[model samples]
Target: MTDHADLLELAVEVAREAAALVTERRRAGVEVADTKTSPTDVVTEVDHAAEELIRDRLLAARPDDGIVGEEGDDTPSTSGVTWVVDPIDGTVNFLYGIPQYAISIAAKEGDEVVAGVVLDVTKGEAFTATRGGGAHLDGRPVRVRDVVPLEHRLVITGFSYQRETRVKQAAAIARLLGRVRDVRRLGSAALDLCYVACGRADAYVEEGLNEWDLAAGGLVVEEAGGRWAQRPGVGGKRLVLASPAGGFDDFVAAVEGCGFTAS
Candidate 1:
Protein backbone atom coordinates (compact mmCIF):
# COMPACT_ATOMS: atom_id res chain seq x y z
CA MET A 1 0.00 0.00 0.00
CA THR A 2 2.89 2.32 0.73
CA ASP A 3 4.32 1.94 -2.72
CA HIS A 4 0.90 2.39 -4.24
CA ALA A 5 0.38 5.48 -2.14
CA ASP A 6 3.71 6.85 -3.24
CA LEU A 7 2.90 6.17 -6.84
CA LEU A 8 -0.39 7.99 -6.48
CA GLU A 9 1.39 10.95 -4.95
CA LEU A 10 3.86 11.08 -7.81
CA ALA A 11 1.12 10.82 -10.43
CA VAL A 12 -0.96 13.47 -8.74
CA GLU A 13 1.97 15.85 -8.62
CA VAL A 14 2.79 15.24 -12.24
CA ALA A 15 -0.81 15.70 -13.35
CA ARG A 16 -1.18 18.92 -11.39
CA GLU A 17 1.97 20.24 -12.96
CA ALA A 18 0.68 19.33 -16.38
CA ALA A 19 -2.64 20.97 -15.62
CA ALA A 20 -0.90 24.18 -14.60
CA LEU A 21 0.99 24.21 -17.85
CA VAL A 22 -2.25 23.70 -19.74
CA THR A 23 -3.88 26.52 -17.83
CA GLU A 24 -1.05 28.94 -18.44
CA ARG A 25 -0.94 28.14 -22.12
CA ARG A 26 -4.69 28.26 -22.60
CA ARG A 27 -4.93 31.58 -20.82
CA ALA A 28 -1.89 33.02 -22.58
CA GLY A 29 -3.20 31.93 -26.01
CA VAL A 30 -2.78 29.02 -28.46
CA GLU A 31 -0.81 30.47 -31.36
CA VAL A 32 0.25 27.35 -33.21
CA ALA A 33 -2.41 24.85 -34.30
CA ASP A 34 -2.06 21.55 -36.10
CA THR A 35 -4.47 18.89 -37.30
CA LYS A 36 -4.14 15.14 -37.30
CA THR A 37 -6.02 12.33 -39.12
CA SER A 38 -8.71 14.89 -39.96
CA PRO A 39 -9.62 18.50 -39.31
CA THR A 40 -11.40 17.50 -36.14
CA ASP A 41 -8.39 15.88 -34.48
CA VAL A 42 -6.18 18.67 -33.12
CA VAL A 43 -2.97 19.46 -31.27
CA THR A 44 -1.84 22.85 -30.01
CA GLU A 45 1.17 24.46 -28.40
CA VAL A 46 -0.21 23.66 -24.96
CA ASP A 47 -0.48 19.93 -25.56
CA HIS A 48 3.17 19.61 -26.47
CA ALA A 49 4.28 21.89 -23.64
CA ALA A 50 2.15 20.03 -21.13
CA GLU A 51 3.44 16.62 -22.22
CA GLU A 52 7.01 17.80 -21.91
CA LEU A 53 6.25 19.02 -18.41
CA ILE A 54 4.76 15.65 -17.48
CA ARG A 55 7.61 13.66 -19.05
CA ASP A 56 10.19 15.66 -17.17
CA ARG A 57 8.55 15.21 -13.78
CA LEU A 58 7.69 11.53 -14.17
CA LEU A 59 10.96 10.41 -15.75
CA ALA A 60 13.00 12.39 -13.26
CA ALA A 61 11.24 10.74 -10.38
CA ARG A 62 11.33 7.23 -11.82
CA PRO A 63 13.88 7.14 -14.58
CA ASP A 64 13.47 3.45 -15.32
CA ASP A 65 9.80 3.64 -16.19
CA GLY A 66 8.86 3.87 -19.88
CA ILE A 67 6.66 6.73 -21.06
CA VAL A 68 4.04 6.76 -23.78
CA GLY A 69 2.17 9.95 -24.62
CA GLU A 70 -0.48 10.91 -27.13
CA GLU A 71 1.48 13.93 -28.30
CA GLY A 72 4.93 12.38 -28.07
CA ASP A 73 6.85 9.31 -29.14
CA ASP A 74 6.78 6.05 -27.18
CA THR A 75 9.88 5.47 -25.07
CA PRO A 76 9.96 1.81 -24.19
CA SER A 77 10.62 1.04 -20.57
CA THR A 78 12.81 -1.82 -19.39
CA SER A 79 11.52 -1.73 -15.80
CA GLY A 80 8.01 -2.92 -16.57
CA VAL A 81 6.70 0.34 -15.18
CA THR A 82 5.15 2.34 -17.97
CA TRP A 83 3.76 5.83 -17.54
CA VAL A 84 1.06 6.75 -20.03
CA VAL A 85 -0.12 10.30 -20.60
CA ASP A 86 -2.77 12.31 -22.39
CA PRO A 87 -1.60 15.86 -21.90
CA ILE A 88 -4.83 17.33 -23.11
CA ASP A 89 -7.68 14.86 -23.25
CA GLY A 90 -9.92 17.26 -25.15
CA THR A 91 -7.78 19.39 -27.35
CA VAL A 92 -10.75 20.39 -29.46
CA ASN A 93 -12.48 21.61 -26.35
CA PHE A 94 -9.35 23.35 -25.14
CA LEU A 95 -8.82 25.14 -28.42
CA TYR A 96 -12.44 26.17 -28.60
CA GLY A 97 -12.55 27.56 -25.03
CA ILE A 98 -14.51 24.71 -23.51
CA PRO A 99 -13.67 23.89 -19.92
CA GLN A 100 -14.51 20.17 -19.99
CA TYR A 101 -11.06 18.82 -20.82
CA ALA A 102 -8.56 17.13 -18.48
CA ILE A 103 -5.00 15.93 -18.05
CA SER A 104 -4.67 12.12 -17.67
CA ILE A 105 -1.70 10.13 -16.38
CA ALA A 106 -1.32 6.52 -15.34
CA ALA A 107 1.45 4.10 -14.35
CA LYS A 108 1.26 0.45 -15.30
CA GLU A 109 3.15 -2.48 -13.88
CA GLY A 110 3.41 -4.94 -16.75
CA ASP A 111 -0.09 -4.73 -18.25
CA GLU A 112 -1.91 -3.71 -15.07
CA VAL A 113 -2.42 -0.09 -14.16
CA VAL A 114 -1.21 0.52 -10.60
CA ALA A 115 -1.77 4.26 -10.27
CA GLY A 116 -3.78 6.92 -12.10
CA VAL A 117 -4.66 10.61 -12.04
CA VAL A 118 -7.09 12.82 -13.96
CA LEU A 119 -6.89 16.54 -13.32
CA ASP A 120 -9.59 18.86 -14.63
CA VAL A 121 -7.53 21.94 -15.17
CA THR A 122 -10.42 24.32 -15.66
CA LYS A 123 -12.00 23.35 -12.34
CA GLY A 124 -8.83 22.68 -10.37
CA GLU A 125 -10.33 19.30 -9.54
CA ALA A 126 -8.24 16.14 -9.34
CA PHE A 127 -9.11 12.43 -9.29
CA THR A 128 -6.59 9.74 -8.34
CA ALA A 129 -6.67 5.96 -8.02
CA THR A 130 -4.44 3.03 -7.23
CA ARG A 131 -4.91 -0.64 -8.15
CA GLY A 132 -6.23 -1.79 -4.75
CA GLY A 133 -6.49 1.38 -2.71
CA GLY A 134 -9.71 2.76 -4.20
CA ALA A 135 -10.24 6.12 -5.95
CA HIS A 136 -10.33 9.65 -4.63
CA LEU A 137 -11.44 13.12 -5.67
CA ASP A 138 -9.40 15.96 -4.27
CA GLY A 139 -7.96 13.59 -1.62
CA ARG A 140 -11.35 12.33 -0.46
CA PRO A 141 -12.68 8.89 -1.29
CA VAL A 142 -15.28 8.70 -4.04
CA ARG A 143 -17.28 5.97 -5.72
CA VAL A 144 -19.69 5.48 -8.60
CA ARG A 145 -23.40 6.08 -8.25
CA ASP A 146 -25.67 3.05 -7.82
CA VAL A 147 -28.17 4.09 -10.49
CA VAL A 148 -29.76 1.04 -12.11
CA PRO A 149 -32.94 1.66 -14.07
CA LEU A 150 -32.70 2.66 -17.71
CA GLU A 151 -35.21 5.47 -17.20
CA HIS A 152 -33.03 7.00 -14.51
CA ARG A 153 -29.62 6.32 -15.96
CA LEU A 154 -27.52 9.14 -17.39
CA VAL A 155 -24.77 8.15 -19.80
CA ILE A 156 -21.81 9.85 -21.46
CA THR A 157 -20.11 8.86 -24.70
CA GLY A 158 -17.68 9.96 -27.43
CA PHE A 159 -17.59 9.45 -31.18
CA SER A 160 -14.77 8.39 -33.48
CA TYR A 161 -12.78 10.68 -35.78
CA GLN A 162 -13.07 8.38 -38.77
CA ARG A 163 -16.04 9.53 -40.93
CA GLU A 164 -17.51 6.09 -41.51
CA THR A 165 -16.94 5.09 -37.92
CA ARG A 166 -18.49 8.34 -36.73
CA VAL A 167 -21.67 7.63 -38.67
CA LYS A 168 -21.96 4.20 -37.11
CA GLN A 169 -21.15 5.61 -33.70
CA ALA A 170 -23.83 8.27 -34.16
CA ALA A 171 -26.52 5.76 -35.02
CA ALA A 172 -25.69 3.78 -31.90
CA ILE A 173 -25.88 6.93 -29.78
CA ALA A 174 -29.20 7.85 -31.35
CA ARG A 175 -30.68 4.50 -30.34
CA LEU A 176 -29.20 4.73 -26.86
CA LEU A 177 -30.37 8.30 -26.33
CA GLY A 178 -33.98 7.37 -26.88
CA ARG A 179 -33.66 4.43 -24.46
CA VAL A 180 -31.80 6.18 -21.65
CA ARG A 181 -32.80 9.00 -19.32
CA ASP A 182 -30.28 11.21 -21.12
CA VAL A 183 -26.96 11.10 -22.93
CA ARG A 184 -24.11 13.56 -23.36
CA ARG A 185 -20.96 13.85 -25.43
CA LEU A 186 -18.53 15.57 -23.10
CA GLY A 187 -15.57 15.64 -25.55
CA SER A 188 -13.15 14.74 -22.78
CA ALA A 189 -13.05 11.01 -22.03
CA ALA A 190 -10.84 11.41 -18.97
CA LEU A 191 -13.24 13.81 -17.26
CA ASP A 192 -16.23 11.76 -18.36
CA LEU A 193 -14.91 8.57 -16.73
CA CYS A 194 -13.83 10.49 -13.66
CA TYR A 195 -17.38 11.80 -13.50
CA VAL A 196 -18.59 8.19 -13.60
CA ALA A 197 -16.17 7.29 -10.78
CA CYS A 198 -17.42 10.04 -8.46
CA GLY A 199 -21.11 9.57 -9.27
CA ARG A 200 -21.38 12.68 -11.40
CA ALA A 201 -22.19 10.56 -14.45
CA ASP A 202 -23.82 7.15 -14.27
CA ALA A 203 -21.84 5.47 -17.07
CA TYR A 204 -19.54 6.14 -20.03
CA VAL A 205 -18.62 4.35 -23.25
CA GLU A 206 -16.31 5.18 -26.12
CA GLU A 207 -14.46 3.57 -29.00
CA GLY A 208 -11.00 3.89 -30.58
CA LEU A 209 -9.21 5.17 -27.49
CA ASN A 210 -5.46 4.90 -27.22
CA GLU A 211 -3.96 3.88 -23.88
CA TRP A 212 -3.13 7.47 -22.99
CA ASP A 213 -6.77 8.48 -23.26
CA LEU A 214 -8.25 5.79 -21.01
CA ALA A 215 -5.51 4.63 -18.67
CA ALA A 216 -6.02 6.98 -15.71
CA GLY A 217 -9.77 7.35 -15.90
CA GLY A 218 -10.44 3.64 -16.43
CA LEU A 219 -8.44 2.71 -13.35
CA VAL A 220 -10.20 5.44 -11.40
CA VAL A 221 -13.57 4.08 -12.41
CA GLU A 222 -12.61 0.57 -11.24
CA GLU A 223 -11.27 1.87 -7.94
CA ALA A 224 -14.49 3.78 -7.37
CA GLY A 225 -16.55 0.54 -7.44
CA GLY A 226 -17.46 0.74 -11.11
CA ARG A 227 -17.16 -2.15 -13.57
CA TRP A 228 -15.41 -2.07 -16.96
CA ALA A 229 -16.00 -4.21 -20.04
CA GLN A 230 -16.38 -4.24 -23.77
CA ARG A 231 -19.99 -3.98 -24.96
CA PRO A 232 -21.77 -7.34 -24.88
CA GLY A 233 -21.12 -9.50 -27.98
CA VAL A 234 -18.54 -6.94 -28.98
CA GLY A 235 -14.79 -7.23 -29.10
CA GLY A 236 -12.21 -5.17 -27.17
CA LYS A 237 -12.07 -2.43 -29.82
CA ARG A 238 -15.80 -2.07 -30.26
CA LEU A 239 -16.57 0.06 -27.27
CA VAL A 240 -15.09 0.35 -23.83
CA LEU A 241 -18.06 0.42 -21.48
CA ALA A 242 -18.01 1.34 -17.80
CA SER A 243 -20.63 1.91 -15.16
CA PRO A 244 -21.27 1.57 -11.45
CA ALA A 245 -21.45 -1.98 -10.13
CA GLY A 246 -25.17 -1.59 -9.52
CA GLY A 247 -25.78 -0.28 -13.03
CA PHE A 248 -23.54 -2.68 -14.94
CA ASP A 249 -26.23 -4.94 -16.30
CA ASP A 250 -28.41 -2.08 -17.51
CA PHE A 251 -25.43 -0.40 -19.14
CA VAL A 252 -24.53 -3.57 -20.97
CA ALA A 253 -28.13 -3.94 -22.10
CA ALA A 254 -28.29 -0.37 -23.32
CA VAL A 255 -25.13 -0.73 -25.37
CA GLU A 256 -25.89 -4.24 -26.61
CA GLY A 257 -27.03 -2.97 -30.00
CA CYS A 258 -23.87 -1.06 -30.87
CA GLY A 259 -22.07 -2.10 -34.07
CA PHE A 260 -18.70 -3.30 -32.99
CA THR A 261 -15.75 -5.07 -34.51
CA ALA A 262 -15.37 -8.82 -34.10
CA SER A 263 -13.02 -10.31 -31.56
Candidate 2:
Protein backbone atom coordinates (compact mmCIF):
# COMPACT_ATOMS: atom_id res chain seq x y z
CA MET A 1 0.00 0.00 0.00
CA THR A 2 1.22 3.48 -0.73
CA ASP A 3 1.74 5.73 2.27
CA HIS A 4 -0.97 8.33 2.77
CA ALA A 5 1.68 10.98 3.25
CA ASP A 6 3.25 10.08 -0.07
CA LEU A 7 -0.13 10.14 -1.72
CA LEU A 8 -0.76 13.59 -0.24
CA GLU A 9 2.54 14.79 -1.61
CA LEU A 10 1.74 13.43 -5.05
CA ALA A 11 -1.71 15.02 -5.01
CA VAL A 12 -0.31 18.41 -4.02
CA GLU A 13 2.47 18.21 -6.62
CA VAL A 14 0.19 17.20 -9.46
CA ALA A 15 -2.48 19.73 -8.52
CA ARG A 16 0.06 22.54 -8.34
CA GLU A 17 1.58 21.55 -11.67
CA ALA A 18 -1.82 21.48 -13.31
CA ALA A 19 -2.72 24.81 -11.70
CA ALA A 20 0.43 26.39 -13.10
CA LEU A 21 -0.42 25.13 -16.55
CA VAL A 22 -3.90 26.63 -16.26
CA THR A 23 -2.51 29.93 -15.04
CA GLU A 24 -0.02 30.17 -17.93
CA ARG A 25 -2.66 29.27 -20.47
CA ARG A 26 -5.07 31.85 -19.09
CA ARG A 27 -2.34 34.42 -19.27
CA ALA A 28 -1.80 33.58 -22.92
CA GLY A 29 -5.57 33.60 -23.59
CA VAL A 30 -7.23 30.47 -24.97
CA GLU A 31 -10.41 29.86 -26.99
CA VAL A 32 -13.47 27.99 -25.79
CA ALA A 33 -13.53 24.72 -27.72
CA ASP A 34 -16.94 23.43 -26.67
CA THR A 35 -19.73 23.25 -24.13
CA LYS A 36 -21.13 20.27 -22.24
CA THR A 37 -24.71 19.74 -21.07
CA SER A 38 -25.57 23.35 -21.98
CA PRO A 39 -24.25 26.41 -23.77
CA THR A 40 -23.45 27.92 -20.40
CA ASP A 41 -21.36 24.86 -19.51
CA VAL A 42 -18.20 25.92 -21.30
CA VAL A 43 -14.94 24.08 -21.91
CA THR A 44 -11.69 25.58 -23.14
CA GLU A 45 -8.51 24.09 -24.54
CA VAL A 46 -6.73 24.86 -21.27
CA ASP A 47 -8.97 22.42 -19.42
CA HIS A 48 -7.90 19.57 -21.66
CA ALA A 49 -4.26 20.59 -21.62
CA ALA A 50 -4.22 20.80 -17.84
CA GLU A 51 -5.90 17.41 -17.43
CA GLU A 52 -3.43 15.84 -19.84
CA LEU A 53 -0.53 17.32 -17.92
CA ILE A 54 -1.85 15.91 -14.65
CA ARG A 55 -2.53 12.47 -16.20
CA ASP A 56 0.94 12.32 -17.68
CA ARG A 57 2.62 13.24 -14.41
CA LEU A 58 0.55 10.83 -12.31
CA LEU A 59 0.94 7.87 -14.71
CA ALA A 60 4.65 8.50 -15.04
CA ALA A 61 4.97 8.50 -11.26
CA ARG A 62 2.72 5.47 -10.67
CA PRO A 63 1.93 3.52 -13.81
CA ASP A 64 -0.31 1.04 -11.98
CA ASP A 65 -2.60 3.70 -10.57
CA GLY A 66 -5.87 4.66 -12.26
CA ILE A 67 -7.12 8.13 -13.19
CA VAL A 68 -10.62 9.63 -13.28
CA GLY A 69 -10.57 13.15 -14.63
CA GLU A 70 -13.27 15.65 -15.51
CA GLU A 71 -12.01 16.30 -19.03
CA GLY A 72 -10.72 12.85 -19.98
CA ASP A 73 -11.84 9.24 -20.19
CA ASP A 74 -11.51 7.19 -17.02
CA THR A 75 -8.53 4.85 -16.79
CA PRO A 76 -8.67 1.71 -14.65
CA SER A 77 -5.76 0.61 -12.52
CA THR A 78 -4.31 -2.70 -11.44
CA SER A 79 -3.31 -1.06 -8.16
CA GLY A 80 -5.86 -0.20 -5.54
CA VAL A 81 -5.19 3.52 -5.85
CA THR A 82 -7.19 5.76 -8.20
CA TRP A 83 -6.70 9.46 -8.68
CA VAL A 84 -9.68 11.81 -9.15
CA VAL A 85 -8.81 15.12 -10.73
CA ASP A 86 -10.47 18.35 -11.77
CA PRO A 87 -7.91 20.23 -13.81
CA ILE A 88 -9.99 23.39 -13.62
CA ASP A 89 -12.78 23.57 -11.09
CA GLY A 90 -14.13 26.97 -12.12
CA THR A 91 -13.97 27.29 -15.89
CA VAL A 92 -16.41 30.20 -15.95
CA ASN A 93 -14.37 32.04 -13.33
CA PHE A 94 -11.22 31.24 -15.27
CA LEU A 95 -12.78 32.50 -18.48
CA TYR A 96 -13.82 35.72 -16.78
CA GLY A 97 -10.34 36.16 -15.30
CA ILE A 98 -11.69 35.58 -11.81
CA PRO A 99 -9.19 34.25 -9.29
CA GLN A 100 -11.41 31.58 -7.72
CA TYR A 101 -10.53 28.75 -10.11
CA ALA A 102 -8.56 25.75 -8.85
CA ILE A 103 -6.83 22.49 -9.69
CA SER A 104 -8.06 19.65 -7.50
CA ILE A 105 -6.66 16.12 -7.07
CA ALA A 106 -7.31 13.23 -4.74
CA ALA A 107 -6.03 9.69 -4.19
CA LYS A 108 -8.71 7.15 -3.42
CA GLU A 109 -7.91 3.75 -2.01
CA GLY A 110 -10.81 1.54 -2.91
CA ASP A 111 -13.84 3.62 -1.83
CA GLU A 112 -11.90 5.76 0.64
CA VAL A 113 -9.96 8.87 -0.15
CA VAL A 114 -6.53 8.57 1.48
CA ALA A 115 -5.11 11.90 0.35
CA GLY A 116 -6.20 15.09 -1.34
CA VAL A 117 -5.16 18.58 -2.46
CA VAL A 118 -6.83 21.63 -3.96
CA LEU A 119 -4.66 24.37 -5.42
CA ASP A 120 -6.07 27.91 -5.70
CA VAL A 121 -4.52 28.67 -9.05
CA THR A 122 -4.45 32.45 -8.93
CA LYS A 123 -3.82 32.73 -5.21
CA GLY A 124 -1.11 30.05 -5.14
CA GLU A 125 -2.58 28.58 -1.97
CA ALA A 126 -2.33 24.83 -1.56
CA PHE A 127 -4.88 23.13 0.68
CA THR A 128 -4.04 19.51 1.51
CA ALA A 129 -4.99 16.60 3.76
CA THR A 130 -4.38 12.90 4.43
CA ARG A 131 -6.90 10.58 6.03
CA GLY A 132 -6.42 10.63 9.83
CA GLY A 133 -4.14 13.66 9.37
CA GLY A 134 -5.40 17.21 9.79
CA ALA A 135 -6.05 19.59 6.89
CA HIS A 136 -3.75 22.50 6.10
CA LEU A 137 -3.52 25.74 4.14
CA ASP A 138 -0.05 26.49 2.92
CA GLY A 139 1.45 24.15 5.60
CA ARG A 140 -0.55 25.65 8.46
CA PRO A 141 -3.30 23.57 10.04
CA VAL A 142 -6.88 24.77 9.62
CA ARG A 143 -10.18 23.98 11.29
CA VAL A 144 -13.82 24.80 10.64
CA ARG A 145 -15.42 27.56 12.65
CA ASP A 146 -16.89 26.64 15.99
CA VAL A 147 -20.55 26.80 16.99
CA VAL A 148 -22.68 29.43 15.26
CA PRO A 149 -26.40 29.83 14.94
CA LEU A 150 -27.94 28.81 11.61
CA GLU A 151 -29.25 32.33 10.89
CA HIS A 152 -25.86 33.80 11.68
CA ARG A 153 -23.96 31.42 9.44
CA LEU A 154 -22.69 32.54 6.07
CA VAL A 155 -23.17 29.88 3.39
CA ILE A 156 -21.44 29.39 0.08
CA THR A 157 -22.93 27.52 -2.86
CA GLY A 158 -22.88 26.98 -6.65
CA PHE A 159 -25.39 26.68 -9.49
CA SER A 160 -25.64 24.19 -12.33
CA TYR A 161 -24.80 25.36 -15.82
CA GLN A 162 -28.04 24.01 -17.26
CA ARG A 163 -30.60 26.80 -17.27
CA GLU A 164 -33.40 24.57 -16.02
CA THR A 165 -31.39 23.35 -13.08
CA ARG A 166 -30.13 26.83 -12.39
CA VAL A 167 -33.67 28.13 -12.28
CA LYS A 168 -34.62 25.55 -9.69
CA GLN A 169 -31.41 26.16 -7.80
CA ALA A 170 -31.95 29.90 -7.83
CA ALA A 171 -35.43 29.47 -6.41
CA ALA A 172 -33.99 27.33 -3.63
CA ILE A 173 -31.38 29.98 -2.96
CA ALA A 174 -34.02 32.66 -2.69
CA ARG A 175 -35.77 30.66 0.00
CA LEU A 176 -32.46 30.05 1.77
CA LEU A 177 -31.21 33.63 1.63
CA GLY A 178 -33.60 35.06 4.22
CA ARG A 179 -32.90 32.22 6.64
CA VAL A 180 -29.11 32.60 6.69
CA ARG A 181 -26.77 35.48 7.35
CA ASP A 182 -26.10 35.68 3.62
CA VAL A 183 -25.45 33.52 0.57
CA ARG A 184 -22.50 33.57 -1.80
CA ARG A 185 -22.06 31.79 -5.12
CA LEU A 186 -18.33 31.47 -5.71
CA GLY A 187 -18.54 29.49 -9.01
CA SER A 188 -16.15 26.86 -7.72
CA ALA A 189 -17.32 23.92 -5.64
CA ALA A 190 -13.78 22.89 -4.67
CA LEU A 191 -12.97 26.27 -3.11
CA ASP A 192 -16.36 26.50 -1.46
CA LEU A 193 -15.63 23.25 0.41
CA CYS A 194 -12.19 24.49 1.37
CA TYR A 195 -13.64 27.77 2.65
CA VAL A 196 -15.89 25.78 4.93
CA ALA A 197 -12.86 23.80 6.10
CA CYS A 198 -10.73 26.83 6.82
CA GLY A 199 -13.37 28.93 8.54
CA ARG A 200 -13.79 31.30 5.63
CA ALA A 201 -17.42 30.23 5.29
CA ASP A 202 -19.67 28.67 7.89
CA ALA A 203 -21.22 26.20 5.45
CA TYR A 204 -21.38 25.04 1.82
CA VAL A 205 -24.18 23.30 -0.08
CA GLU A 206 -24.64 22.50 -3.71
CA GLU A 207 -25.92 19.91 -6.20
CA GLY A 208 -24.76 18.75 -9.65
CA LEU A 209 -21.16 18.28 -8.59
CA ASN A 210 -18.89 15.55 -9.99
CA GLU A 211 -16.65 13.30 -7.88
CA TRP A 212 -13.56 15.20 -8.91
CA ASP A 213 -15.14 18.47 -7.79
CA LEU A 214 -15.70 17.26 -4.23
CA ALA A 215 -13.20 14.47 -3.64
CA ALA A 216 -10.23 16.64 -2.73
CA GLY A 217 -12.06 19.42 -0.89
CA GLY A 218 -14.29 16.97 1.01
CA LEU A 219 -11.28 15.39 2.68
CA VAL A 220 -10.01 18.80 3.65
CA VAL A 221 -13.32 19.66 5.30
CA GLU A 222 -13.48 16.33 7.17
CA GLU A 223 -9.98 16.69 8.46
CA ALA A 224 -10.74 20.22 9.58
CA GLY A 225 -13.33 18.93 12.06
CA GLY A 226 -16.33 19.39 9.79
CA ARG A 227 -19.04 16.97 8.67
CA TRP A 228 -20.71 16.51 5.28
CA ALA A 229 -23.64 14.60 3.82
CA GLN A 230 -24.45 13.63 0.24
CA ARG A 231 -28.13 13.08 -0.37
CA PRO A 232 -30.25 12.14 -3.35
CA GLY A 233 -31.36 15.22 -5.26
CA VAL A 234 -33.78 15.65 -8.15
CA GLY A 235 -33.19 13.25 -11.06
CA GLY A 236 -31.06 10.96 -8.87
CA LYS A 237 -28.21 13.46 -8.78
CA ARG A 238 -26.42 14.07 -5.48
CA LEU A 239 -26.52 17.19 -3.32
CA VAL A 240 -23.68 17.84 -0.85
CA LEU A 241 -23.74 19.90 2.34
CA ALA A 242 -20.77 20.59 4.59
CA SER A 243 -20.57 22.53 7.82
CA PRO A 244 -18.73 22.74 11.10
CA ALA A 245 -19.51 19.94 13.54
CA GLY A 246 -21.69 22.05 15.78
CA GLY A 247 -23.69 23.62 12.97
CA PHE A 248 -24.11 20.66 10.62
CA ASP A 249 -27.56 19.48 11.66
CA ASP A 250 -29.08 22.95 11.52
CA PHE A 251 -27.48 23.70 8.19
CA VAL A 252 -28.76 20.41 6.80
CA ALA A 253 -32.25 21.11 8.01
CA ALA A 254 -32.26 24.63 6.58
CA VAL A 255 -31.26 23.40 3.12
CA GLU A 256 -33.61 20.43 3.32
CA GLY A 257 -36.45 22.80 4.04
CA CYS A 258 -35.72 24.34 0.66
CA GLY A 259 -36.36 20.87 -0.90
CA PHE A 260 -32.83 19.49 -0.89
CA THR A 261 -33.15 15.92 0.34
CA ALA A 262 -30.68 14.68 2.91
CA SER A 263 -29.56 11.09 3.05
Strongest candidate by TM-score: 2
RMSD to the native, candidate 1? 2.3
RMSD of each: 2.3, 1.4
Clashing pairs in 2: none
The deviation in Å at residue 145 for candidate 2 is 0.3
**Could you give candidate 2's per-residue lDDT for residues 169-239 as a string of tens digits?**
78788999989899999999999999999999999989888899999999999999999889876434689
> 6-71 in candidate 1: lDDT tens per residue?
888998888888887788878888854687767778889888889999999988988888999998
- TM-scores, each model vs. reference: 0.93, 0.97
Give the whole-model CA lDDT for all candidates, comma-separated.
Answer: 0.84, 0.90
Model 1, C-alpha of 163: deviation from truth (Å):
1.9
